[model samples]
Target chain A: MMPTEDIYQPLLNVIEFLGTFAFAISGIRHAAAKRFDWFGGFVCGVAVAIGGGTLRDIMLGVTPFWMTSSIYLICTFMAQMFVIVFARSLKSLDNTWFFFDTLGLALFTVAGLQKTLDCGHAFWVAIIMGTITGSAGGVIRDVLLNNVPVIFQKEIYAMASIIGGLAYWALVELGCDMTISVITAFLLIVAIRILAVKYHISLPVLRGEE
Target chain B: MMPTEDIYQPLLNVIEFLGTFAFAISGIRHAAAKRFDWFGGFVCGVAVAIGGGTLRDIMLGVTPFWMTSSIYLICTFMAQMFVIVFARSLKSLDNTWFFFDTLGLALFTVAGLQKTLDCGHAFWVAIIMGTITGSAGGVIRDVLLNNVPVIFQKEIYAMASIIGGLAYWALVELGCDMTISVITAFLLIVAIRILAVKYHISLPVLRGEE
Candidate 1:
């Protein structure tokens, strides 16, 4: 299943680009923390921003959206620029960046779910795809930077995506318009993520025998 | 291009299964070293064994080979069994495992190249895909384990795949049969990797300004 021509495509593209920029910035921050060179940081950022969508697109049997569009690449470059120019004051800007990152995750989750639904997959598969689109990039970034993936840790990250996906599913089942359902899902994810962080809510750590 | 129906497919399947087994075992060994539980280890092993091929298949806009085949999952299970049953003597079996891992890389590189060529891609693209098939799993494993990727700082790993791909390309250009070219290229990768490890030949560490 592929995206049919849509009059709303241009607006959707804007949302996608915003998400890409924030995700890339998050990736760049991690790479910089690990002292990767400029080129390495840029590559890492691109990987983080586009990795999930690329995987989803491949699974969908379409050419990767990033490969077809220069905008995503340019967004990554801009992410690198943000890191470079704000290097000295980044710690102070953490909250601001975190806001954008959360918004990006929300937007991406909506996009992922809508795309999967458009492909005519079942709800459960759509949930998984939406979660992957929202969180896989961060997992890849953590891995590349030699850190335990945050998703597997105490952060309520992927859970937010799952819950948000269910919310979208429920809305669609009730005959909600596609745009309204998407926005509802997006807001749900953003609100969940923000509240989780603000309240320091976390899943219990798994205990394995030493 | 997709796999044409071939009489020799059984033999190819055998090679692919062998490679998957070895790759899975390599991933399991890493997981064990990190003290991950059996379930964690099994998951890790499966990720390493099929991660590269999955990526390649998706990029080529085909169903991931593992999705249609049970053999790959079975092979990962066998790898876990080998690890569990041989736990006491596994450390001493490192060299034996290394041999299989090298063989896996060689076989996978050949498979990747053939698939890319079948898809009507140019030789350079085939080479890149071949290297990805051989190396991406290890990169993923290293990242998941919070270790620096060996590909970024190791013995002639991806280089061997590149050189082997070049050999295959040259042989085909000179009118060699596809089977012979694949075999020669596979052997070349195996030999180079083994020799590189035996000689401790590593790429120089890149020094970035601290």
Candidate 2:
């Protein structure tokens, strides 16, 4: 009999590819604003697309997924193309980028939690990894774009991931089915991100000493 | 019998710790210039100190050094304390930060090369990883501070690391004593960085479309 991961691996790959593409678009758009050349834009896209997962894999003591697969690079290149082709139209739709970014964040969080569990980490560790996987790429992208990370600012980004992670941890702890727990966490992340954006909700601004 | 690594491990640890502290100070200083709060400064400091090594370790398929050791964190914290206490005094020493930063870069490049060799990677990979270890942290720090990375600017920062890495690779290929190889590469990095600054040497900047 095939292992459970093998059974689910194809679906996971699809989700991951979509997430990577979206993250790449977000990064590429940011790079465009800075007038990065084609190579710089491509590099920025790839960095944002894979940065979080690479970080997660490192912490989990595994070879990075991108090193073993060409798909991610191809997807990021495709994302760059998409941005260039639709630059004018995409610029008009302010929420379009936000939608894809949130969807990617939700999908990545669940995938990260699963990978952490597979690596035999504790629930708390899994939650942290989940949040990192969802949010760290954006942090890297924002940094590359030369701005304060939106997550660290008055944005509910990382906090949404954290909540989803907590929900996943609780579901697993309460002996829920694995699929049910994953779906619940994924939905929670998506919903939280949407609501936060729609409501203009944000974390409190951190005050510096005067 | 103890392994050879054990014999030299303490010395490596000391070098790594000093590099970490210096890197943290550089990061904290940048964050302070941006008016970041204490927590933000601390996070940036930690990121700059550990970011390059973490990325190298990930690419090298090893657990991140900071994850396994509390010493890096402790060193970063001490750097933070030093910054807070000497804020007024340090503000006057324009070149002191550059000196420590260059020393840390040289030390980290050699240490990173040694670790990659221990992992049985090829010489070229070790050289690239060494360059990443020496330069990537400052890139991350610059990004976090919302500025163009100094490495990508006209500065010869990464070039200095690349030169050092090439020297290390050549020495190893020539079957030079490992200690001599490390020392020679370290000094080369420091000398190159100093000369670059003194002579205003830099790479040609890439021009984007007008």
Model 2 per-residue lDDT tens digits across residues B31-113:
77776656557667978998999899878777777755577877988988888877777756658777877888888888788
What would the per-residue lDDT of candidate 2 be over residues A1-210, giving only the tens digit for each residue?
Answer: 012457677876666677788899888888899999888889889888988888788789888878998998999999999888888987776576677778889888887888887887767667767887888887877776767876654567777888999998898889998778888898899999999888998753323223
Model 1: per-residue Cα lDDT over A108-191, one tens digit each: 777788787777666766776788788888877876776777665457777889899999889989999777787788889999
Off by over 4 Å in 1: A1-54, A61-131, A140-146, A153-210, B1-7, B35-47, B54-89, B199-210
The top-ranked prediction according to TM-score is: 2
Residue B132 of model 2, lDDT score: 92
Q: Mind giving the per-residue lDDT tens digits that candidate 1 earns over B87-121?
A: 76777877877887888899888888889888899
Query: Chain A alone, TM-score for each of the models?
Result: 0.91, 0.91
Please give the range of 10 consecutive residues that has the lowest summed lDDT in model 1 chain A.
A201-210
| Docking class of predicted structure 1 | incorrect
